[model samples]
Target: MAATTAVQTKKKKDRTFVTTMKRLLKNKLAIFGLIIILLQVVMAIAAPVITIHSPFKQNLAQSELPLFSEGHFLGTDNFGRDLWSRIVYGARISLLVGITAVGLGLAGGVTLGLIAGYYRRLDGIIMRIVDLLFAFPGILLAMLIIAVLGTSLVNVAIAISIWSIPTCARIVRGSVLSVKKQEYVQAMKSLGASDFRILVKHILPNCSAPIIVFATMRMATAILSTASLSYLGLGAQPPTPEWGAMISQGQDFMWTSPHMTIVPGIAIMLIVFAFNVVGDGLRDALDPNMNLNQ
Candidate 1:
């Protein structure tokens, strides 16, 4: 009987996944966004093979070459580094930092949220701290963190992760508050399930839909924040092939070698757009009110 019930549960999950995907794919803009994201992933993974020139290597004689110039597909920067190579490699940093920061934020935020929602005594204390963090503007908070932590890519990631925690905590807390009141959770408690087991094995899983949607949308914000920090010289430093730093460097030569800034700018814009659209699609697709067959 238990085996049959387990099989039925698995099948239900499978069907839900299929339905979600079908709904998501029905959105043309989301499909376009997914393609862009996939391309960025491929470019990040195959950067070495995709670019002929070294992103860091310089040839002063070839500096500031225009677009589609000989041997330089996207042209050379002020330092004669390949623009295409730098953009391609920069994808790795953007994706890595965004994902790593979001994962860390989710870890910390979800813990606090679960504890706060499940244990009412801690809710007031936890939420006060979260509210305090939320009072500050995100970029200013991130800048303050970077100032205290000092500059570096890793520091930027840490700062962004910290900045992300309050919002994630609030989201998780709300979801947890709603899910905990459900009948299944009450049944689990009556069955003598441990608090940890009830939270992790049951409550958390039910709260995941919103978490997933938040994570997807947060990726865009994370990438944009990383770029902004880098542009301000608080993140990735000179010659690191970071997109924001590249744009910062290219700003001086805007009139002469605008391609340097434009290329990275376009890359950043497209990536953020892709994540945003995909996130929107996921939110809609995950809605129970959405007609699965439609």
Candidate 2:
């Protein structure tokens, strides 16, 4: 009877924790954001299947076709490329940039943050560098990097990753500082656990919540940044179906076929907005103090 009671008590605690998490997810705005994010992901994945026109194929005769015209649903650009098709393909560039840049930033930042947080003497030096990077606006820093590296997809990713690093590092460092002072960490030290083991097992797991939230937010920023770079001719080159490049290519035809520019612009706005909403929701959902109403 005693053993059964103990098992039931443990299960109850676990259920309570899960219920709390569910309550956080119950926020309608967060749920909506999640849905939109998922929808975008699906659209990106299904881009090829959804569109018949190759994003690169151009029809000068049908140039600047407006929405709902002829065969083109969203219309055609100055180059007569299908707007809908271009937008679908553009998703690949945006997702690629967002994921790659954030992944690089997260990996580098977390590693540096852990090292600095664990070693008291190194903290000051590492944080100073982060602070210096943070002083400049991320966009401006990306611009500078792009200018120096020259216009290319790889350069855009690198520039955005550079801007992302400081913020990610700061977040991870703060989380690590908090976790390092915990009793478990102290116990680990007393047990003569290796530094790597303590950091990987005891510290990193507890710091994940904040890191995840930051990463989500950074993804939105990365997408926007990539677009901005492409707008400036520093990203995915001509004939490539990138949203920013599409907008740039369509600008001249804006007076004739506004849908050319407007469609791609809307796509960028929607993607960035969706990501921001989802990121905000994730932050709220991950808050430990939140409770689900029964």
Candidate 3:
């Protein structure tokens, strides 16, 4: 009977996922966003193969070349580094930091949320910590962590992850609170199921909808925040092909070689847009009240 019930549950979950995906695909904005994200991912992965020239090698002679110049499709920065190569490589950095930071933040947030929501005795203490973190503005909080950890790409990711923790925990805690009140959760408690088993198997599965939405939206925030930090000279440093850093480098040549800054700025905007629209789509698709048929 237990095995049969488990099989039914698995089938139901699969059906739900398929339905959500079908709904998501029906959103035109989401399809466009996915295309943009896919293109960026392809460019990032094929950086070495697709790039016309080295992103870092400087050539004073070719410095500040106009866009569409031979051997330099997108032109060159002040240092004569290939704008196309730098932009392509920058995608790798942006995506890496965004994904890593969010992954870490989600892991920490989910654990704390599970403990706090499951154990009434721990909820107060855990929530207090989350509240304290939330007291600071997100960017300010990230800056403070970066100040202590010192500036570096790795440190930037860590700081952003720390900054992300409070919001993720709050979201997860709310979801958990609601989920744990469900009849199934109460039944699990009375059936001698371990706290770990109940939380991980039953409670977390039910809470996945909100968590998925949060993660998608948070990816947009994470990538944008990374660019902001790097632009402020606190994230990826000089010589790094990070889009924010590239923009910073090109600011001086904005008049003569505007593509240096404009190209990378556009890259950032497109990626952020991609994530935001996809997130919006996921939220709508995952909402139980949203009719999939419509």
Candidate 4:
């Protein structure tokens, strides 16, 4: 009976923590961004059902039509591809690239950062390499990488991941440094806990909040970087409904059909904005000193 009561009490405490988190995340800007991001996800998932025309199917007669034409609502592009369909499908490309690149960076950076932070002797060598990568602007670094790897979806993802690694590693190192000084971590060290056990069981868990917030922010940056690469003809090759590729295709006809460029541009802006808002919200919500009821 005592064990059951204790288990229930622990569960209640966890639920309280989750509820407090939800209350903090109710910030208007954050909620609005979450809604917009959710809508885009749904639109991407329902692309086929949402659009009447195929994203790649062309109709020369309907080419360059304006928004709200007789049949097309968002109109057609230079190749007579449906603007709405292309935009809907393009969400998939942006989201996939953002998530995949950030996931790769998070995996590699966190491992390296934890090791470098826990081992002082390794810090200098690891950080110097990070600094070297950081010397160039992220977009330029990605461009150079893509140029070497040759343009392709996989190559673009790899480039973005590489560019993202240094930032993630730096953020994780900062978090780990703060966590290592906590009394609990020191107490574990005094008890003769193995370095690996202390780090994995004590330090890393405490430092996860900042790492999560940074990852969310990095996702937005990754998306923009991938788009830039695609714009330069290094990602999501022709006939693919990538937002950046769509923008590149529409650039030549910017005067005649501004919607082609503007629509995709808007999509990219909204997605990046959504991620930034969510990241900011998470940072605030995860702060232990923050009082939601106040």
Report lDDT per candidate: 0.93, 0.85, 0.90, 0.86
Model 3 Cα lDDT, one tens digit per residue, 1-294: 999988998998888888898999999999999999999999989999998788889999998888899998888888888888999999999999999999999999988888888888999999999999989999999999999999998998899888888888888888898999999889988999999999999889888888888888888898999999999999998899999988888898888878988999999999999999999999999988875455
Reference-based TM-score, model 1? 0.97
Ranking by lDDT: 1, 3, 4, 2
Compose the digit string of candidate 2's lDDT tens values, residues 89-208: 898889988999999989889998998888989999999999899899988998898889898988899889888888888888888988899987898899899999999977998888
Residue 77 of model 4, lDDT score: 91
* Candidates sorted by TM-score, best first: 1, 3, 2, 4
Over the stretch 1-294, how does candidate 4's per-residue lDDT look in tens digits? 979967996897587569657865678898888888899889988888988889889999789999998778998997788888888989988888888999998888888789888888999999999999999998888889888989898888888898888888898888888789888788879989999999787788777888888888988898888788888898999899998988998999999999989999999999999999988988888776674454
What's the TM-score of every candidate structure? 0.97, 0.92, 0.97, 0.91
Q: Kindly give the stretch of ten consecutive residues in candidate 4 with the minimal lDDT sum.
A: 285-294
Model 2 pairs in collision: 23-292
Off by over 4 Å in 1: 291-294
Q: Report the Cα lDDT for residue 259, model 2.
A: 81
Which whole-number lDDT from 0 to 100 does residue 112 have in model 1?
A: 89
**Candidate 4 has which clashing residue pairs, if any?**
none
